[model samples]
Target: MKVSKLAVKILENESVVYYDPIYHGRTLKVIGIDDDPVEVMEYLLAQYKEKGYSIVVFDTSGHFPTGLFESVLRIEEGNPAGLDPLKMARMGIIKDPYSAVTIVQTIYELDSASTDKLYADFVTGKVNSIADAVKAKKNYSEIILEGYTDLDEMLFSGDPVRIPESGLIDLSGLNSVTLTGMAFLILAAAMEERRRVVYGLYDIAVLTFTGAGNAGLPLLTRPARRRVAILGTKYPLDQVLSIPGPTLLLYNDPDVQSAIYESQGVPAGLRAFIDKGEGAYIWRSPETINVEFGKVLKLQP
Candidate 1:
């Protein structure tokens, strides 16, 4: 079946509950079941936007398709606080005198034979090791950052918090709380900038550091034009209950289903594969339904 039809299915399920028994209809929450639900999600988002509705995705697993997004904000171990000077520069957080001093001191601190090569790399966005050393200068007795500029704190602070342009964001290596906070920061910035967004966060467990008090709960409670999808095998029911919209489950693992039932007293249907290749059976949430699996249409050159 076409993806639009799947969107119609989830949206059409009025039996889908959004409010918990304790909350008494004050909040919104619905459970959707499908194999390869990411594809279903992408299609659902397209359907919403086709009718002028805005949509947002919280890819908690970072497993969503990367090519579909216009821009990408990646937060992972690859670009840590002290090592991502290019990202800092691109965000306009580093500039002029402070930028110059940081680079100069970093260059001097490195072994002299490689200074010119490393400087060239930094200028070309090919390296951040120099910036890394400059950030950690306290550890090295020989390197001292001397000059102070108007943007001194920004350059020297070693905090790599940047608002990525609106697009696909990968928050891979950050702790859950940090991931949620950064997502809110970026999404808030996107709204202010009047930008359309489809953001993804991998490993959402980090967002629930404090059980029901998880920071992401409020994010779900807020009313917005975006369609946020929080994908994972296990999500605390309190956290899941706070989702003000539809919650899709791609895999029907017993642990996940049990967690949902135990935490929220809600029943998420069990998974059944009725057929191979064409589609599968996802029975139990509200009703039984057959779902289509997405395929790779072509390989990149």
Candidate 2:
């Protein structure tokens, strides 16, 4: 579908259409049943970029196209260049120290005592890298070292990675625990940078997460100062609904479909017709309306 298709949607009647800009800072949840939700996300990202919105995506699905963004950070074996948690901490770029510590503890499975020691070191600037922390304590040496061996040295060593204004952080291939930790660090740093440099009164930050599911939940909940457009796919339906934002729900399972219809106050009889018909349902404030989504663009290289 052409990009213009998303600008407006037909209401209950075929002749009546409503203008929907899908504006920034509006949280959107796109849930797909048999369709690929990522395609719709990419389309929206492209549109957002054209309108000059900065984009930051935490991707668990490696398939997301990186070419759309100006900068790309991949968390893979031996990349040697990515976010460095310790470096960010020392630079005072990580705004949420508690979250950062939580990430560390979760990743290494450090006990409370070990976690406390690490947190202290982080705050005191006594350790610049995980390697330094490991050397400082023999008990944590094995677990910390073993856990990070596959990651690039830049992640645990070297200078801090710069958070891009428009970028994608590829967290694919890693286990859920590691993915969550890395995402939190990256998100914290990005949010701090954004806060430090107030872009503009109307500037918008579009944060998209695909295939992140529960791992992406924490990052999604972080507070921001500027206008933001939060988009998520493969997340729990009920959780997304609870976030207090406009939602664009595509085709879904019966239970989810029924739940969405019920939540929107769509008549029980109309649910089946709407289910079998083309287009998606969008619930914005006081009403829910059926709308056609733009066609998915071909995957970018």
Candidate 3:
């Protein structure tokens, strides 16, 4: 099957079977399902958040579908419990009811500006008020407003290039990874507030090499504990081997299997298990004894 199709299959009908060779070769299956990929992801994130699953990675090979972000947003739109002004006040993010109004007013005022200088001026004037209202040690609103204002200047500062009306974000000129990162930020913030589910996607190489030290790292650190890091990439084992925790490889590529065996010096029989027709390879670490094979039970549609 195509990679995308395989991903959907995995999400739709996948289950993991655990087998312990030392205990009479007993096996158990974890049968789990969800409404969609987003829900499946949210469930996994909840596992990380509440069940101590720690780090979860999907490694979608950078073919991570663009539509999935929109799907997540659609789910959020159907639920009406995210980022309310009243909630913001209750959370002490704003000083009073009027402060919430001020934030909205500030947003509108800046958005209404017909000229760039006007937008910049409005943000400059509102920065202190927002800072005062924001109780956090670090002022996220100020940073976002100012940074967005500066980014806007850089993008629109030049003779305006006409952008076609395409989608929520114009995909004409922007790279997919950049779009993915932006969409993830917006979605994750809402998810964290409403559902308390944190999610992130990163390059396998960066996640493996730098771990959490990479600046602006989206996933929370290990001690903060509950975060899912899905590293979707098209790289080989040599490039993708330094992940900090247990990893589940979703793809069934021969090159990857070969790399795994060669890197860990495992027996050739292991290939039979790793090359399961419709399951993921579970590798807890670089050790040869820590691998398992399982498949998603096919379910009726």
Best by lDDT: 2
How displaced is residue 240 in candidate 1, in Å? Answer: 2.7
Off by over 4 Å in 3: 1-71, 74-227, 230-240, 261-273, 285-289, 297-300
Error of 3 at 235 (Å): 4.1
Between candidates 1 and 3, the TM-score winner: 1
Model 1 agreement with the true structure over 19-49: per-residue lDDT tens digits: 1112121122323333244554454445435
Per-model TM values vs. the true structure: 0.43, 0.65, 0.38
**Tens digit of per-residue lDDT, candidate 2, span 84-183:** 6665666766666655665566556678877787777777877666667777764555666666554534455446667666778665645444444554
lDDT of each: 0.39, 0.52, 0.32
**Which scores greater on lDDT, model 2 or model 3?**
2
List candidate 2 segments past 4 Å from native: 1-25, 95-99, 109-116, 138-158, 173-177, 180-185, 192-216, 220-225, 234-244, 253-256, 259-277, 282-301
Better model by lDDT: candidate 1 vs candidate 3: 1
What C-alpha lDDT does candidate 3 achieve relative to the native structure?
0.32
How many residue pairs clash in model 2?
2
Per-residue lDDT of 1-301 in model 3, one digit per residue for the tens? 2121112222223343432212211111111111122223333433333433332222213322333222221112112213333234434443344434333333323342222333243344432233332322333433435434332223222221221111112222323343223323222222232222233343333333321122113333221322224333334335444433333444345666566455544456655434333343333333344545554333232
